[model samples]
Target: MGVVEALVGATVFDGETRRHGVAVLVTDGRIAAVLPEHAVPAGAVVTDLGGGLLTAGFIDAQVNGGGGVMLNDGPTADAMAAIARAHRPYGTTALLPTLITDTPAATAAAIAAAIEAAPTRPGVIGLHLEGPHLAPARRGAHVAELMRPLTEADADQLVAATEAIGVLMVTVAVEQAPPRLIRRLADGGVVVSLGHTDATYDDVVRAVDAGARGATHLFNAMSPLGHRAPGMAGAALDAGSLWCGLIADGHHVHPATLGIAIRGKRGPGRCFLVTDAMSTVGTEGTTFLLNGRTARRENGRLTLDDGTLAGADIDMAASVRLLVERVGVDADEALRMASAWPADYLGIAEMRGRIRAGLQADLVHLSDRLEVKATWIAGERDEA
Candidate 1:
């Protein structure tokens, strides 16, 4: 019953196919219709986008900071808002504010902040707790001294947090969190993901059985695939039910390996793109601190002084470009990896990540060169 606006002329990629000369009608923050250009209502406010490509906005499952602000700096609603505002122009309309390995107090603060911020922050889909519970041997960029096993108390707190905050994703090492704890978190509606692990294939299989449905930044902090062993990396590729998040920056994963992951993974579940981005993403800074150590950004990659990979400097638009121009993924599939697949992985596909009637009108408009022209979150243009 609210105002209806039509987005016209651009090619609309509706999460499945790209259609030409169509108009997307949005009413009351939801998609009201998708029709031929000629069918747009006579009185509807129309925004013609020339020949740009309009698709679902990118959804990043891991974002630490942006706009010179890191989540670890404040762990407050204002900090979350700053991060969201900073990334909105880069084509990310929704994201999980990731808290990397930190003290228990810091973790709790981040959780509380995300819960408080989600209702007010349009781009904040949820929070991703990347660890305190992880394998120290595989804890890349995380403080080794802070790594610990998941306790019953920890599990209980997570369950309660999930109840308070919808779409809570916890990335843990399978070798650390017992199968029972994994099941408990999953049953309580927490997305349990395997990450920072050196677990063997068998260990990963057991974790999968207990509802660990995803892997965080595959092949980076985890054990690599061996010819005979097929460690955590191999298990992630082999597990048909598991979704793997890939950093498509061409540094974290080579294009050849990215191609293999795209071709080899059996799905219902598929490999999707995640920024695993840090404070340097949408800002001018070339350095930031992670757990009291400085991570320098150089040559489009973030690394510690010791040269361990920290996070990434890539944004959603750049990742899509890499997939299309370098990795040879079709443009539509590349867009889906940045948008729809992440939505599906987060279990929010029905309401977002697609262009359809009754779905939230979250869209990104891209120029022919694949650069971000503009983005809309829930039908409102982000002016940032």
Candidate 2:
């Protein structure tokens, strides 16, 4: 009989707290235990990684595409696989492949493909339908023809259809989503996020009360916060409980503003980082088509040729590095931003975020330079 335990020697970061020099034990595809320095388990497969830092594998609740596949351009199981392969080495363990606003048939097809893919590919969480329910005034990069105001029937049918197919997230503008849609989704086990909105502070309060607990991409694709009206952006900024996703690509939100969001949400449900990356993410040569527009990479960011905010060209690691280097956040804090916070927002914190015992063995190893050295998921190391 063979032992099924594995040991990750030396580097460890518990994801929520701080770093440690420990040996992480994995057995039967879950983290069995974590032993401290100099503690060795007999007959275990030991991978002596020396001094590389290891933390929980990143979970992106929002991802569109990577490698060469755009989930929006006919998303499929293969597309999801391509996305995962592209992001895996970059340190993402699991992800929800998002499909931006498109026709109903297209949306339904993407949902079906995601359902078909989810069982086979554990890397994929589900599908995030980012629109068809957005305020047209703030429909960033999304096709205006596909945008629709959320009505009761639209909400009901969408919930039913997506729930039936295992798709579990939707992003809507508070200003346009139906009266109690947020509450209903929250109750129905769907994660709701606010974006592409122009709601006033009062309207935001109403939505929060109705169960919208997260803001999509903080300051982008929504009304900017100003002193006079204190738009939805302000409401999100001040909402201590809301999970704010900041694109740390330096283009979406400036580094200074990123610091403010981190400061504001630094408590219970603090800020986090996301790639919000588009199709060209993993491909070389720096160009891809977003909704028929040609997006190019310039100065470490991705955008349309005329400079529309297309999406991030960076990966989760770059976002983390930006936080540590530019925003002056400590490495452990930045690690939490990329791992734990986002996991908590999706309500999967218990499973994949933190590097605690009984959690899934989804972990990333980074060199001193903050580059990805390796990644492991459920006791198996990936292509680094």
Question: Residue-wise lDDT of candidate 1 within 17-101, one digit each (tens)?
Answer: 9999999999999999999989998889998988989999899999988888888767888888888888899899999888988
Top candidate, metric lDDT: 1
Overall lDDT per candidate, in order of appearance: 0.91, 0.80
Report backbone clashes per prediction: 0, 1
lDDT tens per residue, model 2, 56-78: 99888778889877888877888
User: Which pairs of residues have clashing backbones in candidate 1?
Assistant: none
> Model 1: what TM-score?
0.98
Residue pairs that clash (backbone atoms under 3 angstroms), model 2: 265-270
Judged by lDDT against the true structure, how good is candidate 1?
A: 0.91
Model 1 alpha-carbon miss at residue 110, Å: 0.8
Name the 10 consecutive residues with the lowest summed lDDT in model 1.
375-384
